[model samples]
Target: MPLGRGYLALAALATTGGLAACGREQQTYCADQNGVVVPDVRCDDGSPGYYYYTGSYGRGRRPGYRLGGGSRIASTDSNGRARAGLPSTGHVSNGHVTSGGFGSSGHGSSGG
Candidate 1:
């Protein structure tokens, strides 16, 4: 028994293969330590169980949900954008959140 070209092509098209669209980007959402997707506000206000989840496979302009991983979107935001003060990159996994985003240990910066 041998595999046909059609079957091979289909398998290749599936999963993380070369056939993936070059101009495709998905929504980089925020999740909790348990990897549960929640409202953007929760992640922004430094609420408990709040963290960023980067499941975007490729780089596309359109914003969409992650095709991989296990997560349930809590709710959609009126504005599709992460609130201010929350870093766009990096994730907090220690179950300790800082309100001022990256490099913030709940301490105010002092510099004149």
Candidate 2:
């Protein structure tokens, strides 16, 4: 027998509900690092990693976490900045580089 429109509507609703339930069964990852909530995922790679909680879309930035060497977890500072071993300059802060040189202003040859 052919199904009635109401029956089809009910079936569709049931299917959607089932799909929603399936989604709910999905996993998520969440972690707290240094007073920062680092979601279960990678901020750079944007992939799911290590843990599940049924509520993670596996997107968005995960604070204190960085994807390095392809799918590896790297440590980050409290400001979410990665720790690197590059040579440090004596005059730089907040991404601005400053230097005292010659023939310009302070702490340089005044062309005497």
What tens digits encode model 2's per-residue C-alpha lDDT throughout 1-112? 8999999999999988766654332112223322233533332232333211112223343445432211111222211121121112121111112221221121111111
On the 0 to 100 scale, the lDDT of residue 66 in model 1 is 33
Q: What tens digits encode model 1's per-residue C-alpha lDDT throughout 1-112? A: 9999999888877744533443223334455555544445565554545444433333331223333541222223212123422243334221223223232222211110
Let me know the TM-score candidate 2 reaches against the reference structure: 0.28
Instruction: Indicate the residue-level lDDT of 73 in model 2.
Output: 19
User: What are the lDDT figures for the candidates, one per model?
Assistant: 0.37, 0.28
Q: How accurate is candidate 1 locally (lDDT)?
A: 0.37
What's the TM-score of each model vs. the native? Answer: 0.32, 0.28
lDDT of 1 at 16: 43
